[model samples]
Target: MTRFALTVEYDGRPFMGWQRQRHGPSVQQAIEEAAFAVTGEVATVHAAGRTDAGVHGLAMRAHLDVAKPFAAFRLMEALNARLRPAPVAILACNEVADDWHARFSCVGRSYEYRIINRRAPLTFERGLAWHVARPLDAEAMHVAAQRLVGLHDFTTFRSAHCQSASPVKTLDRLAVVRDGERVLVRTAARSFLHHQVRSMVGCLAQVGLGRWSADDVTAALEARDRQRLALNAPPDGLFFVAASY
Candidate 1:
């Protein structure tokens, strides 16, 4: 058997999430089926992270083991050919050591949240970004976001469904920036709890709207209570930007 690393990109709007689901479609199932079609073997695909429904991926790293004999380039080509019309693409592929796991070996992950700060209705970015009609102070959001950096109990930003052993995590970076009518929130960490990014973005948005002060963010983090969260941003604007090994 051979282990192969894959760089995948997909539109998350058509699936439930990255993992396979009994009631709905998923990115994993689509890729696994495409692999089966190419190799005639049941192979499980593992990803660096599993994003929620409506959360897109720009360069999701994944891996799968196959018993079939094929070159790395040919395997990538075959998978892409079989994955046609699924909105999922294999951007790159390479043979890797058997111990190099996609999830376990990952050292860091990054995500980006996009907000269209405009009153006009979205045309091209309808499902790709969040539209906030009210004007937002990106600088204020950036100031408030800094409070979330470093080690802290992030229960306030964690989802009730989160399975992480502890709510305490070190946020490596969180930055909010605006260009024209676009507000972007970029964050990186070793790993994140369920809805953690969305939750943080939601509270920062409140700060941008002048509803909450920077100290309020500090208070919320210190509270370590989920109810203290100002909001949970929708998945529409979240993107899994990259995963590092």
Candidate 2:
């Protein structure tokens, strides 16, 4: 069997997230179906991250193994051709060793959350970003985000349904910046607790809106309790931006 690694980009508004579901469409199902169309053999596509519904992917890393022999480029083109109208694209593809894995081999991952801090309704980017009518202090948010950087017990930011065995994770960076009316929050880590980024963003938004202070963020992290969470931001603005092996 030959293993092929694929870099994928997709608009996640129409699917039930990255994983295949019995009830709805999924990015994995789409790519797997396309793979069968190309190789005439069943395959399973594994990703570096499993994003929630409505969470887009700018450059998600995934891999699959096939028994049939085919050039990497030919397989990529065939998959793209057959995956038409799915809003999912195979951006790059290459052969990898059989032992390589898309998820377990990944060493780093990054995500970005976009918020349009404006009152006007979205026209072209309706479901692509989080629309906040209130003005956000990106500087304040950045200051508050620093509290979340480095290693910590992030139980306060984890999801109730998270399957990870441990809540202790090291965050490399979390920065908030403003590009015109858009507020961008970018984060990097070796791994993150489920909903950790969204939960951090929601509390930072409170600080930006003057409802919470930077000290409150530190306090929350120290409390290490899920009930102390400020809010859980919607998945609309989150994007799996990059993954490194």
lDDT of each: 0.96, 0.95
Writing each residue's lDDT as its tens digit, candidate 1 over 90-146 gives 999999999999999999999999999999999988888999999999999999999
TM-score of each: 0.99, 0.99
Mark the regions of model 2 whose C-alpha exceeds 4 Å error after superposition. Answer: none
lDDT of 1 at 18: 98
Task: Judge candidate 1 against the unseen true structure and give its global Cα lDDT, from 0 to 1.
Answer: 0.96
lDDT of 2 by residue, 65-157 (tens): 989888999989999999998999999999999999999999999999999999898888888998889999999999999999999999999
Model 2 score (lDDT): 0.95
Measured by lDDT, the strongest candidate is 1
